[model samples]
Target: MPRYEYRCRTCGDTFELSRPMAQSSAPAACPDGHEDTVKLLSAVAVGGTASAAPAGSGGGCCGGGCCG
Candidate 1:
């Protein structure tokens, strides 16, 4: 299960919940029992090393920013 961040509009409190993706969009209540809460858009981070391209091998002028 992925954790989701939510904010209560009534009491202005932020909270988190661990639930399934299917219920991610469902309504959530804050710790204070405020039902006027909204789900926040979270940023996902992906990590990995990308292989570099060979030297002098690219789309030419545009790739090298030679187009002014």
Candidate 2:
């Protein structure tokens, strides 16, 4: 199951729910019992930063002493 973000047009409430992909865009009742709701775009968890060094950089002090 995938998570989806939803916003309620009636109560102006925002929340997330885990449901099947088929229900991703289905109309869902608000937690406050409101029947009018709209599905919002999902947000990314993180920026996906790379922590390791790039390939072919080599294990040297300054690119094989080019800067030395």
Candidate 3:
């Protein structure tokens, strides 16, 4: 399941919901029972390690400082 952010125009409140991607475009009501709501744009962050470059290398243009 993915989480989505929403804002209620009636009460000016923001909320979140966990739902399937199919229903991501579906309308959602606010906690205060406000039907005038709109989905908000969300940003995703990815974190990981890069192993493309070997140790003791500058990892430059060719990952081996060859372009220098």
Candidate 4:
């Protein structure tokens, strides 16, 4: 199951629900019983330890910036 964030247009309430991926896009109602609710686009984040930097890898321009 995955958690989904939704917002109600009628009552202006926001809520969350846990449902199967198959029903992720299904219609949902707000806690205040507002049926005009829409799912919100949420961000996903992954975390891990930073990798070691090679020696002599000082402040050199990378492709990420214009300095690359």
lDDT of 3 by residue, 1-68 (tens): 89999999998999999999999999999999989999999988987668444565765576566775
* Best model number under lDDT: 1
Where does model 4 exceed 4 Å of error?
49-68
> Residue 23 in candidate 1 has what lDDT?
97
Sorting all predicted structures by TM-score, with the top scorer first, yields: 1, 4, 3, 2
| Candidate 2 residue pairs in clash (backbone atoms < 3 Å) | none
Each model's number of backbone clashes?
Answer: 0, 0, 0, 0
Q: Which lDDT values do the candidates have, in the order given?
A: 0.89, 0.81, 0.89, 0.86
Clashing pairs in 3: none
RMSD of each: 3.9, 6.2, 4.7, 4.7
Query: In candidate 2, what are the lDDT values of residues 3-62, reduced to their tens digit?
Result: 888889988999888999987878888889898888898657875448866754776766
- Per-residue lDDT of candidate 4, residues 1-68 (tens digit): 79999999998888999999999999998998889999999999977548856555655556234373
Q: Candidate 3 — worst ten consecutive residues by lDDT sum?
A: 51-60
Candidate 3 TM-score, C-alpha based? 0.67
TM-score pick, better of 1 and 3: 1
* Higher-scoring candidate on TM-score, 1 or 4: 1
How close to the true structure is residue 2 of candidate 3, measured as C-alpha lDDT? 95
TM-score of 2: 0.60
